[model samples]
Target: MNKWPVFCLALSAFLVPTAGAAGQDVQAGQILYDKWCAGCHGFDGAGDGYAADYMLPRPRDFTLGIYQIRTTSNGSLPTDEDLVHVIDKGMPGTAMPGWEAKFSSSQINDVAAYIKTFSPFFEREGAPDPLEFGRQPRREGIAEGREFFEQIECFKCHGDAGRGDGPSAPTLQDDLDFPIRAADLTENWNFNGGGSVEDIYRRLRTGMDGSPMPSFSDLIDAQFMTEEQLWHVAQYVHSLSPEEGPTISDVIVARRFEGDLPASPNDSLWNQAEAFYIPMVGQIIADERWFAPSVDGLWVSAAHNDEQLALLIVWHDPSESPDPKWLEWQQSVAASMFPLLDSVGVTPLPDRLTVQFPTSIPTGRDRPYFLMGDARNPVYLWQWSSQGDVVPEATATGLGNVQPRRGESRTLASSAVWHQGEWRLQFGRSLATPDSEAELQFATGELIPIAFYAWDGSNGEQGSQRAVSSWYGIHLEQPTPPSVYLSPVIAMALTVGLGLLVVWRAQRREEG
Candidate 1:
């Protein structure tokens, strides 16, 4: 054998250490649980409290043990480190406060051990304790997963790979130009707290709420993979981080811009869309659905993009300041949508984006469907009623200020740009066509009128002042990926292989 080959193999083995940590004792854990944790998390770890019912997203029910801040794979308990991180940094946007100052490291460890006692799954059976994440030390699977993120076209929304600077991120904001960026995994401190192995695992499994992160448990069938795999992926994503910049960058600077609109703009459709579009409807509709205050006339002043969102819709919420509780809950639910999609390798943008609005709330027993669209001009509003009846006329509402269109995709504005280190984006009429504007406009001039609208980041905080280069629609029917065709085959093969391996090991044990 070549000595060089042998040395290379040995070197690689040295670089990647196998998980060898032992499990902690649950007996000692019970004491800590009783002393410190049982108050918020009941004796049985069921999330119940006088305050629990009022909390928007509710508290973590440890007995159920479905931790949302985990890095473990689907259907696995969080590791010790996961618990420690949560204890250190309190969860944000919630009642969970960082406890690093309140508890000692040893106390935190005891709590983690105690938390594991609540669920049979956390008993570990024979799994690792500290539960290492990633394959190689220092930085595990960072480069590979980074490539995967881009290979799967995650950059289209999550921008700049791990940095969360995707092209479409700006348009995903709500009434406010809140730029939702991709999760910076390297930052062990999360808004929901917890940086330990299990915490990360839970996040990977359940996903963050009110954001676009989705859950992946369904694809994994909840138990397809070993807990170790989940840990590895979490560690891998976590490792893909950018080097730290000055702490000053942590300060979020507010940007506001102003722009002018054209004369024959699509104000009518815009008004109707607003009048009917529910950003946060009741449970009967979507949780984040909301109805616009009025359809009169308003103009887009600015736009922005922060992290992973691409469709920022920052219209004035004169109708009502969104229920803060509802908004918080929505963020947690929404955060999980994209992550879940990522886990299953689903492309963020599906084939076609569809805009659906109710023509009328529903009359007697008839539900009216409205087909809204943009007129021939990139800036004009158009609509069509879909009750299988007569179409309506082009209505004009002098409330919008979209730039005139000559045909083709209209370029919007860009608010902030991060290059090397400098963060800058123009705040004026820079809307011009960029790549990816194929078949952009829609035409339906006569109906109840509910058109879909999204803002490009070129403008800043308000709607864009620049003439839009073009507008894109949301994917109405996301198709199953071709890999879906191979799901049965893959599942069967893995199942059979695992069964055989188990049988072989059992037989060997018996012979011994």
Candidate 2:
């Protein structure tokens, strides 16, 4: 859909009054809601629609009368206009899509009023002040806010630089006791509270209920911070995007070193390498993907130290894989179809993280398909997965040619840790592992073609049901050689000596 029309509609919604508009029809709203909202939020407003269980942060239970995005103060009910705004804009990074273009103004107005009928809170609390946000401050205001952010221990959970990787980061959880992660402030686009400065300010004061995020309104009063100080922190937060460009890169040059390779995945040394953002598309062929991939972006980073190279991959998933219900459902369906296949028994389908490279980086050779390679050419796959009690490092040269790697215990080191709803996996091996034409060797300053693939077992991804990325380049950056420093001294000496030679040649020419 063309965004200009929707943008114009959203702008108009703010200027004019939407509440008590011509369309106050509850029946009309119900019709529209069923057509749109019922897929994720149940018709009864119980938050148990067909797709709701798979969603992260989950959908709001209207019966609870607690809305995350609201104009009313924290714990207070939202006015009619607040509901209309959310309907028009919708939630950005979730399953909720904006309805600006699909529905007319009357439909939106009608639905906003009708949804309130889901709970008794609307009738009992007849009136509440609809909050209004004003202009944001200049740089001075943001600086003052940064001060308050530190004084009140916001840095403990949000990080000192507001990157969301604070000391207390990995321990966060949701109201249901499920693991949850703090939002990375640098990526403001991921903020569920809305991206505008005003939206940030509102979230700062109101706070998200049922999550680790805390309400600063009470904490502010105790700290003796002025009212304006709150807005400043919001401004400071809004300004926190990485000072250059997106923090993610698709084409990355691995950080190279000469000495000691870092073995620990959590070592601070990994910070020297920048994370690359690998975007994945659904493996839609053959109905391979049973559902839309909840994961879209996978972060990668690499570093090499003479003997070995380490690559890290991380992604977020609300639920862990091998869920008993999902596993049983698939097994039952298989048993009904083919009793022979059922005899194989049921087991956990482990999540897969794979790194791919050209079998050999020779000239005039066509690399294989980003998948397991085409019929004509093959690719090298280094796969990491967990089995009954063993974490295996398997190597494959083609689609179905996987084999156990024969090498030292540390030849291909890999480990995975899931925490706070995110998966972190690190893989490393000898620079010359799988030491044959089947593997692409790592070398400094060499450009190598690489691809990536991921499988989420909880999403019913197995066999061909995986997310994959197109081919991209990886390079090991070359350091300046020590011999380069002597060039300046040689040039200076040559210039002086050549100057005298030229003068003598001129005198000899005059004599001739």
Predicted candidate 2 versus true structure: per-residue lDDT over 407-508, tens digit per residue: 554366687776545678888877775566556677765556677777766444566656766666566656656475334333432333332233235435
Per-residue lDDT tens digits for candidate 1, residues 1-512, read 66999899989766632222344444555666676656666677876644343233445677665654555544455556766777677685355767789777766665677676566775544223432333333435545545544554556655553434455443444212233444444345433545554555556556553445555444345665444444555565655432431121101111111232211222222232211111211111112221111111112211212211112222221112112322332343333322243232111211111122222222222212111223322222321111112111122222232222233433432233224111222222222224223212211111111233322112111121111111111111113344653344333233223322332344356425
Candidate 2's C-alpha runs over 4 A off are 1-22, 141-147, 159-180, 210-212, 219-223, 243-276, 280-353, 358-379, 383-393, 397-402, 408-437, 441-449, 453-512
Separately for all candidates shown, the number of backbone clashes (residues 3 or more apart, or on different chains) is 97, 0
> What lDDT score is found at residue 260 in candidate 1?
28
Per lDDT, the best of the predicted structures is 2
User: How many angstroms is residue 461 displaced in model 2 relative to the true structure, after the best TM-score fit?
Assistant: 12
TM-score of each: 0.32, 0.61
Q: List the residue pairs that clash in candidate 2.
A: none
Q: In candidate 1, how many Å is residue 280 off? A: 22
